[model samples]
Target chain A: MRWKLIIDPVGRPGRDNMGLDSALLRSVQEGGPGSGGDAFLRLYRWDPSCLSFGRNEPATSRYDVEKIRALGLDTVRRPTGGRAVWHDAELTYAVAAPCHAFGSLRQTYLAIHQMLAGAFERLGVTTTLASRRSGRAPRPSAGACFALSAGGEIVVDDRKLVGSAQVRIGKAFLQHGSVLLENGQDVVSGVTMGTIPRVCATSLGEVLGRSIAFEEVARAIALEVRERWSGSWSEESRSPETIESDKFGDVSWTWRR
Target chain B: MSNIPDELRYTEEHEYVRSESDGVVTIGITDYAQGELGDIVYVDLPDVGTEVAKMDVFGTIEAVKAVSELFSPLTGEVVDINTALDGNPSLINQHPYEDGWMIKLRVQNLATIEELMSATDYAQHIGE
Candidate 1:
């Protein structure tokens, strides 16, 4: 039950985001159990929009270079599986644990996701476990990661509210997901899709019946993780050594399929 | 302490080849591959009657960890695919060597099985 969780709101720059996550994974793998003193949960965000693809996806799957340049959005690859996810108008969370520390990887994911389901339930957003059959089965909107909910994803009214992916190396697992709270079409699609294609998005505005602050969502997640795992937090940020290594910050690894 | 059963032949990519009397060879990922893959979530099994060449990508297995390509250990025609994996890919993680067996193939070249490592050699090869 011992863990160390840190919650911080990180600004954009696609390479930096990937760098932070990869560095955290490297730290836990090389640093052994309790890397950075304990298990961690980092909350972050992106600005100016970005399309991030899975680590192993071919580069051709990333973006149409001309389209991306025309749209003025950043495109990069994540060191995780799944499909392309658009980041903007959403809160992203990353949780890292020592291998086999939190039971099995499946259990840990289910536990946290179940907690999220409960939290959303409490928030009056009725949702169910988005199963793989539901996900793998063809949906009209099957092209995007966030548009379709996969097994272990949370869906409200048949639309995905959260999209997640996981990566494990040695004894470390990095699971990250995004929660939508507003229509970010302007930042995301570069143009509004009429009423923002509300089909694939559910915001706190819709859940709470009114607009909600971003901090409140982050706090709720922090409290959920803290309470579920019985952990305390600290205000320390990623070390300068890690940031300076430019390990993940490099465009090569960021864009490398 | 590893789970390389004495009866199965092995490939470097961790697929096991077991020859039956009818000249059909049952193939599946070895225990080591399943262990490294963690909990299997989805398995992309090749369709029956498809031809696959040695070292070619036959299909893929998506684990909670990552999605990895499954390589063919021999050139053969897939006579049967484990349909059970469509709903229970975790079978590979739960029983990689047996109930999780992925495909049964009509061997195009029986001699290739000889090129595969024996269980003891695979154990030694993977440093088990």
Candidate 2:
């Protein structure tokens, strides 16, 4: 009844963090296309800031290259699609497993969102799912994924807290997302004019009227995940070999748009 | 034309067309198109009153995998573009045949409709 759980606190540079994400997804996909029912959980953060765009979303659509370079933000592309996101003052996660493990894609997405929502709720922070409107009309912000609330994204008082995107290969599915616990406007400002909408984001400190330790949030997520999923938790650190050969080590892989 | 609906005309890109009372043809992407695109994320459309020629790229649908252009089935002026797609871009993924309808085209030339797919021909063409 218990699923295997991996809680990795990979705090590294933007390049390495992104690389690890890619490496983990590739390994999980190759492990068995997820049909064998095994799942892996990863928790990570970026030291320096970075910008990520989803697959099929042209990098030229939003990112302002010179400005990002000027701000020293690492730029990369993700296997998922939506819009660009600035990675800073945020903890990101990627959950990989077989498609059937979570049933349909929609169900799988909600299950994870609900897990995060529950964690936030436990902290007494009010949260809700984004209201979905149907139509081809353009939204206000076409730049950052979090700037616009789509169905299933976690939002607090009309502002996004967590924004997730997914890429499914055959039966194996890889989902990546970020949670804001601090101000990342400086990182977001590096993108371009009109790309990053001024979304009001609150950290655990702001929500509780006092500061919440980052380690505490991380521990809560790990503990809650173990309890809820009925699994034993282990903190596994990514190896240098894995980081070099697998992640952030190659620009070609990260830029695979 | 193998999988094409007989009552509905087809565009070369495989969209199905059904004529309406106002001389507009209701358009929706064929099953084959959606199946190939994978799970759709965003659906785009040209504004109303836009004129399009046959096979013109009028809109696009972004799937989890990639983005595919939605082509016009015939030369026409767009009468109405589906607005429900703003929040519900997944409609094309859920019900491409029913609620997923994309746009209404006011026939610029009724003859252009004749070039589209026939149900019988489309069925055989798509190997349905």
Best by TM-score: 1
What local lDDT score does residue B59 receive in model 1, on the 0 to 100 scale? 82
* DockQ (CA atoms), all models: 0.15, 0.08
What is the TM-score of each predicted model, taking all chains together? 0.65, 0.64
lDDT of 2: 0.66
Q: Model 1, A109-189: lDDT tens per residue?
A: 677687677666656667788665421232111245655454666877776777777776656778887777775533433
User: Cα RMSD to native, each candidate?
Assistant: 8.6, 9.8
* Candidate 2: stretches off by over 4 Å: A1-4, A32-37, A137-141, A194-200, A230-257, B1-128
Model 1 pairs whose backbones collide: A99-A171
Clash total of candidate 1? 1
True contacts kept of each: 0.14, 0.04
* Candidate 1 segments exceeding 4 Å error: A32-37, A59-62, A121-124, A134-142, A185-199, A231-241, A244-257, B1-6, B9-128
State the displacement of the C-alpha of residue A238, model 1, in Å, after optimal TM-score superposition.
Answer: 5.8
